[model samples]
Every structure is written in structure tokens, then in C-alpha cells.
Target chain A: MVDDAVQRFCQQDLQLREALGAVIFGQPDAVDGATCALLAGGHLLLVGVPGTGKTKLAESLADSTGLSRGRIQFTPDLLPADILGGETLLPGSSGDRVEFRPGPVFTQLLIADEINRGTPRTQSALLEAMQEYSVTISSHRHRLDPLFSVIATRNPIEMEGTYPLPEAQRDRFLLEVQLHSPAPEVLTRIAAATTIETQMTATKVLEPKQIESMRQTVRRVIAADSVIDRAAHWVAATRPEDPTAPEPVRRGLRLGAGARALQALILSGKVEALRNGRTHLDDEDWKKWRHEVIRHRLVYSLEGELDGLGPEEIVSAVDRAVAHQG
Target chain B: MPASDSQISSRSRRRTPTGLRVPRLEPRLRAGRARILRHCSRRGAASGIAIGLPLATIIWLTDHDPGRAAFTAIGVGLLLATVFASRQRRRAATLWPRIWDRIIGSQSLIETILDRQQQPAGNPWLDALRARSAHLPLPSPTALRRHLPAPDPRPSLALTATAMLIGAVLGPFDPIPEVQLNQDSGSTSVAQISSELPTDEQLRSRQQRIRGREDAALALAGRPALEPLARQIRGLSPATTAPQSLLPRDLQAVQAALQRLAAGDPIIPEVALWNPLLALDSRSPMVTSAALPGDGASLALSTDPGNEAVTRSTALADGGSDRPTDLSPTPFDPQLSAAPIDSIQLAGTATDDASDLRLDTSVVTPPGEESAASWDRVRDDPQLAPRWSRVIDLYQLWIRGKEGSGGG
Candidate 1:
């Protein structure tokens, strides 16, 4: 028995997904992941090879959600101040006053492209804004928009001159959407659609305020103890030291998902339930999105890398082990 | 009004206080839980009975009374089934909501309702959820049965039936009693008859008897080569003459000795004939004698040589009496001729009739004829083989020759 409010929210969510899908061809998972991340009111981390429409997905997410979008092309020389604006002394009629200039992160949706290209020191600049939704510069605190969300993209193939995100920074992201290459048929459609004189753009489907309302509704969605227990079990299974951890996790991981990962899983699962027009969180809702919410938060050991144990494999193993326990 | 705004406003109205009416789904939830518990208990009881029947059959086969054992087994099975059902019911009570949710295909609606019941009221989401699930069907009995199917009792039932059938066919039977043989008794004293191994003393006694018989046979042959055996026989202890001491081989040896003695000389010593005859007659108390065929003289063979009646019979035969005396005594006692015979009157019959009161001794058959008649009766009997038959014939001839000499 879905509520009328949740039913309407589901309708808007469907529209938003359709608009994103129209803009970004053949990446329904990416579109859904991006939509769920926004609705969950958490940041997204897009990981794929270049030209897989990672940036397009981010832009489409912003466009479809009707959030003000800003783009930043991360470079090796970029500084923390470039991401979080600093206070500067401006010329005035009487006395020069230090005025704070908000950076691209201040926008509702900030697209940080090739985020790994930035140095670790510069890439960490968005952490405070992403987590606390506030930035501190020169002993002054600046609050970001309530709808502020960072949609960051990283090119997995471009390893040279790129600093990998530290565990702390990666933990701040709610989900990591991996965009795979389009199939041959999808590629033809992409090419035909993109080569047109007029470029296709995502139509706005949800206002920023409506998304906020939906976020509130997502919070109101019932999460029974059973769902929380399953989430706890899955999170516990990721740790190498946990009794429930599988052999793969114990052998292939140095660090596993933490409480934040559990929070992100349940939060995103709530939004997923609302999108499915349910007022309660289900095991399937969380299970379907577990990899996205937990994969990037895991830190693989040297042995794991040598054994070709990717985060996907580790997370999937933990999921299987936890599911088997249930 | 745009359809989208109208729909949004309508949804907004659902969040108001008026729309916060939580449906009464608890009764249905409780009913579903009870139904699941009942199903679980029934299945548990079925399983218990399936396991219990076979164990009871085993008890019955162990010599316990069939009716009592079967009743006790069924009682224990029911008791265990009750205990197991209680446990299953407890477990099912806790797990029913989740199971129901799974059955109804609701996304944890029943569980959410249950969880929400524990919290403070007035949650619109819970109310809306209840409203949504108000019309959701409780799992039917058919569905419950499908999910918690009864345990298959075929294998256990088959085993129990086979065991019961076996128990019926082979009813209660006594176990074999352990018998401890006496180490001291040279025989099984507790048993009326036993085929146990002979003790050391018994074996030694049988061996000595066999040796004595062998020496006697060699000596009676009267050959110069057998003189050493004859001397050995003269040196043996007289205790070897005990009839009970003779085994089957010893008896055969003694018979051969008598045959050899008769072949060497027609006359046999009286003592030699008496000793072997005593050994042969150990299992039977009767001693038989016959008169010479044409001399009209009789001989009486008796273990008690002092019996006057036998002496008188022998004297009469020596007197050349044509009528032979009855040497056959009553078969019950070999000494019946020497002892006075007593007769008891039948309780309900007349006591005054002299014919009924007195013993009939007037009708006498000659000993030779009686002996011939007895031989004819038993000559072809299985126990008397040709060898034994020949031994008896020899014994009768010796008796006749002894009688003929006495008459001369």
C-alpha cells in the first residue's frame, strides 16, 4: 500500500529517469545511480573510461533534477582555493573589505571532471563541502545550498599524473557509478543522436524544492529493523576482522566499509523504495544498490590488487556471504 | 488545474491529520501468526510420530509385551511431539511476520507494521502503510500448507510396519539361559541329561576300562602271543569291573573277549561269562538264562547266587524232570522270584475273590522256550546289530552247555 505522496514522488522519479536516459544513451544503471544519489542527498562518484558519457551523465543528472550546474576541469596544478573559493580584498569606495567569492562547489550541482587529475591536496578541498555542506576559509564559515551535491568523474584508464582519492575522501561519496561502454547497437544510436546539428539535452523534470520535499519523504519511508539488520550484516561482512566476513574479504581487503557506508546504503535504499512506490525499505531495494554504495568505500590490499580482486568482486563476495547467512 | 499539480495537492492532503487513520491490521497479523504456528506444530508433531513409531517397534521386538510396548511408544511419541510442537510454535511466532510478508509479496509491510506497533503512534507513514496493506490478503490455508508442507512419513511408516509385522510373527520369546557347567561333577549334575565334554576323572576311568577289556580279550584268546596281555589283565585293579565305567568301546572289547574265549574252547568259565554279562547288562536289569535243548534241564542266571528258588529250579532240572520250570521272572524286578510278591486290591472291586487276590504262578513256560521267544521278539531291533545278536546267541549256548554239564 503505497502512500499518495510516495506514489507522486515515484511518478516524478520515473520522469527524471526518463529525461536522463534520453540525454545519456544506453546507461540506464548510470542514470538510475545518479538519480538515486541526488535523491538520497549525497554526492556521486562516476568511474569509467573517457568517452563513456560519465560527464554527460553528470550534466544530465543536474539538468533533469533542475539544479544549477557548475563544471570544473580538474588539472594537476589546481589548488584547494580553486575548488573552495577564498576571501579576497575587493576595491571599495572607502575601505577595502574582504569579500568571499564562492567557488563552483557553491552551486546546487557541481560537475568535477577528471577529478583524479587534481593533486590529493586539491581534490580534498570538496570533502568539507560534500560532508558538512559548508566550507571554512580564513576563519569564516560559508554554508552551501541545501541541494548542493558534487557529481565527480574519474577516468579509470588515465592513471598517469593522477592522484588517487584517499580513503577519507572516497568515503564521503554516497555511490560510485561505473559507466560501461555502450553495446554495438547502442553505439550506433549514440553516434546518430550525437552527430545531429542540434545536440540533445535533458529536459528538466524536478525542481530543487520538489527534490528536497522528496528527500524528506525518503526520510519518512519506513525502514523496518529487518532491513537495518541485513544492512548491518552486509556491512559487517565487508570487514576482514568481522566473524561473518568471507574468505575473499579477509584475503583481498585491507579496509572495509564503515558506518558511513551503511548510512549511504540505507539512505539510498530509502530513495529506491520511494522510486518503486513503496513506503517501506525492502531487502531488494538495498541489495540492488549495495555495490554502488559500498564498492568505492573499500580499500584493497596489495595482495588483493595482485590477485586481481577489484572492489566489485570483494563487495559482491561480501554480499553473497551475508545473503547466504540470512 | 494541471493534472500534475492536482495530483500533487491530492498527495499533499494525505499528509494531513485527517488522513492519518491507521487501519486495524493487527488482528489480521495476529491471525496469520497463529495460523503459521499451528501449521508448524502440526508438522512438528507429524515428524515426531514418524520418528517415534519405529523406536517403539524396536522396543516391542525386545521381548516386551506387544500391546503395552505399542501403547507406551505411542504415548512417548505424543509427549515428544507435544514438546517439539511447543518449541516450533515459539520459533514460528517470532518468524511469522517475515514469512507472511514473503508470502503476500509485500515489501516488508507486515514487518513494518509489527515494528511500528512497538513505537509511539501518530506516524503518517505507518498509517499510510497500514492503509495500503489493509486490503492485502492474509495468506490462505492453502498457501500456508504449500509453504510449510507436512513431513513425509512413508519411510518411517514402512520401517515401523515391517518391524511390527516381525514382532507379531515372532512373539515374545524367552532368551537363552546361561548355563555354567560344574567343574567338579565328572558330569553335568544339574542337567537330567547332557552332552558336555567328559571331565578328566571320567576320561581316565574310561581309558582304564578300555585297557582292561583289551587285556581280557587278548588273554581269553589262549594264544601264546597273548600271554603278556593275559598277565596284564590279572594285574589290573578290580575296580575296572564297575559296569558304569565302561564306554561303548569298552563294551565292544568285552564282547570280543567273550567271543574269543568261546572260540578257543567250548566251555566258558562261569566268572568270565558273568563279568562280561554284568558289563553288558549295566543299562538293563534283566538277566536271561535258558536250558539245554534236548536234556530237559534248565539253568537260572542270577546276580544273587543265594536265591533259593533259583537253586530249587536248578535241582529240579538235575533230577531229570521232563517238565521245565519257569525261569522267567516278573520283568519289573529281577529278584521277584526270591522276594514275596504283594498285591493290593482295587479300591472299588470285591476283595473276597481268591482268583483276583492271588498271583498267577501256575502257568510256567520253559526257560529255553522263553529265551527263544524273547530273542525272536528283539533279534531284528535296531539296537541289536548282527554283532550283538551273535553275542547273545553265544551267551545262550554257554548257558545250555553249563546246564547240560550240571545235569550230567
Candidate 2:
């Protein structure tokens, strides 16, 4: 039974999807993955080459969800303090006390553009705020809103001077949605629309309370033991070290997804099931969303790369193998 | 009790009739699995024979007994097919549960129903999953098989059958009968002939003696008393040693005569076949013998072993001839016949190019079934082809000799 809160959240999610579709033109999967990441209250990573509208899509997410948005354009020289904020001395009535000036990470929605352009040290600074939902500057912790979400974008690693995101930083993202160049029809539509100054603004479809409430409703979704078993099996199958790893993983992978991947899979599956007007998780939900949720978390072996095994192929192999498992 | 549409729908939604129930699904799943296993076994048997027969035929071609080699090939093929079939069956059996999981998971009702069976959620919201997947379709094994492609063994079987038939009929595996004509006088019959051919000197001497005697017999044909018999003998002679259609039959008759001669008998069962009386459609006939009733010291004048031509000559001298050849009296050997041939050249005709004649002595026989039955013939029968038996004996000896030389 879909409760009133879940119903409202699903309706709002559909409205947000429609709104993003109007502006994004052809990237329905990317928009849906981002929405799911937002509803699940986890970070999203948008991976694509430049000029694919990854940044515009993130901006649209911020606009469509009615959340206060802030952006950080990561570069090689970016520092931790730049993202987590710094304290400034302010004279009060009684004495001088240090006031924390929050960085761009303080807003309800933060879009870190070209995140891989930042060095690992700079990237690690967002880890605490992303996982703990709070930033600590000089032992003073500043809490973020319950609706806080990070939608990050990165250029293809082959681009010159771009740093690759480490496995740990990549694992923090709930979903890695790949963006592609628009098809001919969508490109034609985009060209036709952009000829004149058409300042297209997305309609705000959800509030902070609604997002938080939807997360609560998603948490209440029932995930059966068998569904959990399949999820665990799938996650374990990614690890090449495990004896039970699927054939592809055994041959191509050096490292597998950890327990965190399983948690994300099950949690995202619950959200997926709830959004589809169901209050219980099924393997279908897990199978459908697993590639996005777990792809970034996987570490393929050098041999796997040399053999031209992509994360999508590896994940699909595991999916097919697990689906055939007793 | 009367109920509203909502209540009726909700009631029906809680347990969709077609949703998988563990109790019911187990047996159906097992049956589905059994069907797959049966299919594998059936496919293994059909394809195994198809593959085995041809493979066995190939094995037979290496100068092996056609019967035994074929059986070995078939046995080996079936063994391999069985192993592969069982492996496939086990694989299908092991994977069925995962297949069931996906099938059950597809139906929200099945998943919900299974969850309720395992652990019932008290919240009505969670219970609603049953209704969400209530209308989801359930699949049957036939439907699944239709969706998934399984290999059709029929085409493979037909191809294999064709291959096996071709292998049996035309492959080198069949026996090529090598008719080594032991024309030497010392070599009495096939059974008495040694495996090795006569040396060149012995062959030359024997050939010369036989040629000289034949010349003398030709000269003696001018005598009025021997003219008819000489004409008959000339008519019986092969027009050429290059085997003609009549040669084998003639050779078989000669072989029967030699077999009887080797047995030290005066009469051969095949004597009736060579009798000129039979060929001439003459009613009057008499058996001839080299030793007349009263002359034991006289040498038999017949060149052909076991023929009663000398007895016929003596009868003509006595002027009595009124009987079928089958009733002809048995002959006697005075040991004065021309020496047996040393080497009866089995020659083929030369082309118009005037090239030296080359003979193809190897006579190919059809492939026999390589099965338990054919192997039994090889093992148990005494009348099987001597060449095949000799080859088998030589193979066994070679194996033994190799083992001995290897110091095993």
C-alpha cells in the first residue's frame, strides 16, 4: 500500500522528471537517476565529455527541486578549506569570537562541476560532509539541511589534465549516471529552441520537507530476505577474489564492490520500488538500478582493462550470472 | 457476504492465484528440471550414435578389423556424449533455482506472496506489494523454452548419420581384400601359404617350370585323343591376368579345388563348377582320374588339382560316358601334374600410351558394423575373412613384440 507521503513524493518526483525532460531534451535516464539519488539522499556523479550538458542538467536538478543551490568549480589548485569553509575573527559585544564562514557546500543542493579537475586532497574534503551531512571547521561542526544532496559532474578522464576520481571518492556517490550527446531529433529540437533568447526556467516541484519525508517513506519500504540475498550475492559476485564470483568477474576483475555497494543497491532498490507504487523491494528493482548504483564502486583489474572489459559489461555479466544462480 | 469492487479487488489482490507458492512450485520446478535432463539424455543417445559410427569407421581403416574398430569408436563417442550430456543436465539443474527466483521476482504478487509465506509484514502499506504485482504475468516451462533457444539435435543427427553412412561405404576404413595368388606348386592353398611372398629366385624357377609344362600341354593338344580336353582347358583359361568379371569366380573355383587338394582329397566340391560337360549343356559325362582302377603306378595326367579329366580320358579310352558330372567318380593324384604357379600376376591393362602394366591387387570390401556384434564375429568366428584375421593377429604380435623389445 502506497501511503499518502510516498504518493505525494512519487507525484512530485514525476513532476520533477517532466520538468527536467522539458529542459534536458533527451537524457531521461540521467534525469531519473539523478532524481532517485536525490530522493535517496545520496550523492550523484555525472560522467561524460564536455559540452554534453552535464553541468546544465545538475543546475536544472537544483532549480526543479526548489532547493537553494551552490556550485564549486573544482580545479587543480583548489584546497580543502575552499570547500569546507574557514573561520573569521568577528568582534562581538563581550569579546572577539571566531565565526565560521560556510563554503559553497553549505547549501541544500551543491553541484561540484568537473570534480575530477580537483586533486585527491581537495576531493577528500567533501567526503565528511557527504557521509556525515555536516562540515567541521576548527572543531566546530556546522550541520547541513536534511535535504542536502551533492550532484557532481566530471569530464572524461581521457581529457587532458583531468584527474581520475579514486575508488573511495567514487564509492561515496549513490549513482554514476553517464550522459551522452543528444540524438539528432533532440539536437534539432535544442537548436530550434536556442535560436532566440528563450530563458527556460524549470517549475519547482518539491520542497525540502517533501524530500526529507520521501526519504523516510523510502526507508519504510519492505525489502524481503530473498531480495536482500540476491543483492548481497550480486555485490559479492563483483569481487574477483571471492570464490563465488561470476565467470566474467573471476576472469576480468581484480577487485569487487564492498558492503557499501550492497547497502546502496538495497536502499536504492527500496526507493525504486516505492516510487513505482510498491512498498516492497523485488529483484527487478535491484537488477534495474544496480548498474548505476554499483558501477562506480567496482575496481576492474589491469587485465580487465587490457581485455577491454568495461564496468557496464562486467556488471552485466555479474547480473546474468546471478540471475542464473540458484 | 456481498462486497464492493474495492474490497473484492483487494481480496483477490492479496493472493494472486497464479503466483508461485513454494509448495506447488517445487514439484513443477522439479518436473521442469526433469524434462531438461530427459532432453539431454535423449539428445546424447541420438547424437552419440550418429557421431560414434563415423568415428569408429575411421578407426577401422588403419588395417584394423572393421567390426572391432567401429565398436570402439562408437563406444568412445557415446562415452564422451554421455559425459557432456550429464554435465549439461547438471548445469541446467543447478541454474534452475536462479531461474525460478527471476520468474517469481518478476511477479510482484509472487514475491509478495512468498514474503508473506516467509515473514508477514503487519503494515498494510507493505502488504500492498501483493496488489502491485498481482497482475504481473506468470511464465510456464514451454513458454520459457519458446523464449530461449535450445539446440535442435535433429539436424546434427541427420548430418552425423550421413557422415556415418559415407564413412562406412567409402572411407578407407573398409577392408581392401588383397588377393595374393599363391601360384607356386609348393603353396597348396590359402591356408598353407606363408605371410611372405616367394623370393625372386623361387618365383622365377617356379614360373619357368609352369610355362614349360603349359607349352608341352599345348603341343600335346595336337594329338587327336586330347584335342577336346585341350580345347576346354584353353576356353577355361583367363583371357588376361588383368582381372575380368569372370576371374574371381574362376579363382574361387580354383581356390575350392586347391582347398580340397590341400586336404589331400581326390574330389573338390567346386569340380562340378569347372566341368566342361556342365558348361556345354551335355548330358553325357564321366569323372576322370589319373590313377585308373588298375594302374596305381601311373602318374595322373590332370594339371588342374581335383579335376577328373584323366578319368574322363581313360573312360574315352574304354568308351563309356553316360552320367551327370556330379556322379563322376573321384580322381587320384599321381603327383605328375605340372608344378603349381609361383606368382600369378594380378595385372591391370596398360593405357594406350604403351606404358608398363601396373596391377591394383587390393580389392576393397564394404565396412562392417563396428559394434559388439561385429567384434564378436571377429573374436568368435573361424570363417571370417582370413586377411582381416591375419591383420589382427599381426597387430597383436606387433604389440607383443614391441612390449617385449621395450623390456616391459
Candidate 3:
């Protein structure tokens, strides 16, 4: 039974780009990708040059999508207990015994702001809640809500005093959305809106039930075999070659994207197609998803110049190489 | 009917896997798991000599009226062993077909051999090496022996029980044969079975196997036997390393070769074969030529019959007999001719009248029900797959020859 409530609610899921920008502003693509990631039952990564308003976009998308916001400002010192909500026997005022006090990690939207700045030891604490949607602390495993998600962010320019993500950890994100500087016109509107007398707070449009139903609908968006095959081919082409070969492998690219890339590709493609109001994923759907699905996972060579090449550029090259190989 | 988004998967009807599951392995896996659990449970229940012991030792141990206890133990052990073996066999059987399919999936023998990456690593030597070993004489255990050595497989009483008994009795006074029969002597028998050399090719194979393990060779063949066995095969290793142990057959080979040379018959050292073989002529009963295949010392490996024109060779026989050896159809040299491809031919040589193995040429070229298709099915029996796989693997090993060359 298609509940009329869920059916009536997702009309806003159509013009979501505009609704998200009412609060986030200058991050239409990030908000679009994040919203789709939520609908597809996957996670999102918002990586950009610092001060690109990624946090603003995340907050607004959480609002426009009608999800309860759970904020976590990740730091080098943040403990797993603080984020994952471990069992601490806090004594009750009744003078009897203690009880478990869950942490902020229990919410639907877990915003790991500046996620990579935290140490891997601290960052990995969220990995369980990110993937299995669960946390195991002190041997008590608690599976989180099925609608639970993580919108993690990292800045690209800073190299020093930063705990940059290792290759293994970068592979977990569903979409590696790279937020560039907004165009001059968009920035002008952003500047005026921010400095204005009346500030805009996000308005909730989706209920908890609507969010759950939309997740299943997005999953039902059929992915064509050829489009997915092309996606897989590109990821495979990026693996490094052995040194003892007659000639060296042309690039020192580490092993290709993990299973998460396919996951991101399918989810992002579903969102892309649904934005155009199509039922199936197509070539254009993959074309839109290429950067979002692949960027962060494209680990380059040890060469200094190549290391600085944006993940977006490497992923594009990979796509072209795969098409050529095909 | 399409289930709605609100409908829970739990409420949906579950049926036997018509479309419910993947076609292969799922049901098989569940059944295999159940069998394993049952075997483990029996092993847990068994006491005395425990369970899963070898049939031969169990029978031999119980020879001296080993009563209800030994019989019960042997019965339980055999029951468990049969269960364990059938499961192991099934798993091994499943594994072989999968491996064969995998090898078939490979583009060439080179792809089969050096393609250890599971996917392409863009390595050249490994690619080339894999190409060459694909074409060798690989045999099946159906054409060889069936079973391997049956070890003493029973578990012992708890160490706590043994220690308590030892502490009560002044040192210890269990009957010598009764105490250690299943221990050192039973293990000795097991080791002997493993060390038993089936053929000269197998002898070389054993030599090759032990060339890396000196202490193991000494432990296997013993100090008295291994010392000289080690010296004879010093330069004979395919890996170029001599083992420090010996076997009885290897030493006997050296002694026979020395005796033949001293006697001064028409013995040629170039063929690298040394044995006191008494050969009989196909036509005449007197004349003999013991020249065989396998580096001129192993079994008869004939040519493949795919090609019509066989590349043939005929050796001149010069036995120290009054009758001159004559070539019937020769202008100046003997032109031997026959169908190739592992053929069956009658040859009378080194007639060991007491030998147990009845080497019928018929068995070598199996006929009837074992036609090519059925042969594949029979050949894939987990019991026989390793032997066939070995034959192919050895062909690759031969092609690669030395490690200093490729895949460094």
C-alpha cells in the first residue's frame, strides 16, 4: 500500500534542489547529492577547499529532507564513547544503580564536520556506525537506526597540522562531493543573504516515515547493466602494476576503488535519474555521478605533482581510459 | 505480485529455492555443514582409544583379543572415520571440478601456471611460463594408486589421567608392546608406507621431495640408511640442492650400477640407467634389451598419436650371445614404428616373477565405459584429481626449469 502521506510528501522530493538552497545557498549540487545519498540509504562525503559552505549545505539538506539533525564537530581528541555513545554507568539520583547514557551518534543525520582533521584512531570510531550502522563498545553491540547516515567533510588545501585520510578510509564514502567556490553571481547572493538583517533557518519538509519510504523507492530505481559495467571497468583500470614487469606499470596508482564506488555510483545515478524524473539509470545518470562516486577513492602515485592532482581529474581520466579499453 | 514498500520482508512467504536462492552450492553447503557437525559430535562422545583411527592399526591392535573396549573403540573410530572421509571426499570432489573449470577458464597453460595474481598483474615471465607447462603427460590416480597412508588417528586419554597413573605407579610399568605398539611402532609403519617407492619415476620424485629436508630425511630413512642415500643423489636434485638423507632403493641403485660396470657387459653409462634387468626378446626367448623409458630408467612412456608420422628411434642391441642380433626391416638402420599417444605394447624385460603389481597393458589404455567424457567424470574424483593436476603442474615446472631465469 502506497501510503497517501508518503506519496503526498515526496512532491517536494521533485524540486529538492530549490528547497535545499532556500537555507544552504551556493551548494545546489552538494545538497542534491547528499539528499539522494539519504534517499538511496547510503552515506555522503563533502570534501572541498575550506570555507566553501559545506556545513551550511549539510545542515540545510538535513532540514529540507526532514531528517532530525545530529551535529558532531570531529576533533583529534574526540573519543569513540563521545561519538558512538558508549555505556557509562552514570549513577541515577535515586541512589540505587547506574544506567546507560547514549551519545549524539544515535540520530538520523550524523554530521562529522572536518572528519579527516581527527586522528584515524578517532575517525575509525565512527566507521562502524558509518558502515554496519552499528557500534560495538565494551562488547555491547547496538545497531543504529536504519535511516542513520553520516555527512563527513574534509578540507583539501591544508597539508600540515591535519590528519589526512588514509587510502583505506577514503574508500568507505558513498559520494566524495567536491565543493568548489561558487560562481561570482552565486557568491554575491550568498554574501548579501549572509550579511542581511533576517537570517534564514531551515524548514523541515519530510517526516521520519517519508524519509524511510523514499529510501526504498530510490533503491528500486533500476540500474542498467551496461552503465554499471562501465562504472566497474573504470575502477578496475586504476590498479598499480608490479615492478618486475618488462616495462613498469604506467602509473603508481594503488589498487582501484573498493565495492563502495559501485554503491555510490548506483545510488548517485538513482538520484540523478530521479532528478530528471526517470525510472532507470542511464549513461547520462552515470555521467552526472562520475565525480561524486569516484573522486576521493582515486589514490594517485607517490609523485608530488600527481599527488596534488584533484581526485576529480584522476577519476575523469579513469573514465576515459575505461571507455577506450572497452 | 509486487510487494509494497510498507510490507516487511519477514511477512513475505519463504519457499524452497525455486527462485528464492542462487542455483548452486547453497543447499549443498547446508548439508555439508550438518554432516560435519554430526562427525564432530561422535568424536566428542568417543572414549578409550578415541575415534577416527586407521582401520589397519585398529584391526592389528585388536588382534590379541582386545575385548569389548578395543572393539568398541575401533567400531566408533571407523564409524567416525568413514563419516569424516566421505565429507572430505565430497569437499575435495567439489574442489577439483571448480579448479578444473578455473584452469579451463584460463586462456592458456601459461595463464594457468603463473597467473597467481587471480587477475592480471601485467607480468611477462609468469605469462610465458604458464603457456609452456600446459602440454605434458598428466595422469590420474585412477591410472595409479587409490588411497594414501592411514595414520593412527585416535585421540589419547587426557594428560591428567596419564599423569595420575604415572604418579601412583613408581615410574611407569605399562607392557612394552601394549604401551608403545600404537605409538612408535604404529607410526613407524605409517612412515614406511609413505616412504614405499612405487616406481623409479616415483623414486626420483621422492628424492626430489626430500632434497630440501635433511633432518626429515634422516628421521624418515634413519641414520644408518640415509647417510649413503644422501651421497648418491647429491647432484641429482632438480632444485640443485642435495638432501642429507637416504632411502634403501637409492643405495641399492648405486650398488647395482657398480656391479654391472665391474662385470664388463655391453653396459653403457650414457643412458644413465643402472639395474640388473633381464630382458627377453619379443621373438626369441634368449636375447634381451632392458633399455626403458623415464630417463632411460623409469616406466614405458610412449609417444602421442595425434601426429600420423611418429618421430621414431631404434637402439642396436648387442647382447653377449652367440646369435647375432638382426634387424628385419632395415636398409642400414632399424626403423621402429607404432601408433603413439600412450599406447599399450608387450615387452618382456627384467621379469620379476615375484612382483605383485600386474602391469597389464590393457589397464594403461582403459576401454569401454571410460570413453573421453566418462573419463573426465572419473578423473575428477577428488581421489584422483591431485595426480592429474600434478602431471600438468610438473609439465609447467619442467618448462620453467630454474628460478634464476623468470618471475624474479
Q: Tell me, by DockQ, which candidate is best.
A: 1
Cα lDDT tens digits, model 3, A195-291, are 8898776677767787787776666555545457766665555544422211112353555566778777777777666566544455567667777
Candidate 2: lDDT of A28? 91
Report the C-alpha lDDT of model 1 over B26-127, residue by residue, as the tens digit.
Answer: 566657777778888988888777888788677767744668877877787888788778877767766888888877788788887776654543577777
* Cα-based lDDT at residue A238, candidate 2: 90
Q: Candidate 1 or 2, higher lDDT?
A: 1
Q: lDDT of all the models against the reference?
A: 0.71, 0.62, 0.52
Q: Which one is best on lDDT? A: 1
Better model by TM-score, 2 or 3? 2
The model with the greatest TM-score is: 1
Least lDDT summed over 10 consecutive residues: which range in candidate 2 chain B?
A: B359-368
Give the range where candidate 3 chain B is weakest over 10 consecutive residues by summed lDDT: B307-316
The alpha-carbon deviation from the true structure for residue A51 of candidate 2, after best TM-score superposition, in angstroms, is 1.0
For A1-326, candidate 1 gives per-residue lDDT tens digits of 24678888888889999998887888989988988998888999999987899998899887777889889999999999898988899989998998889888889999999999999999889889988999999888999999999999998887789999989999999999999988999999999999999989899888999999888888888998877988989998999889999999999889999999989989999998887778899888887788898888888889888999987788778868986886
Docking class for candidate 1 = acceptable
Clashing pairs in 1: A1-B132
| Top-down lDDT ranking | 1, 2, 3
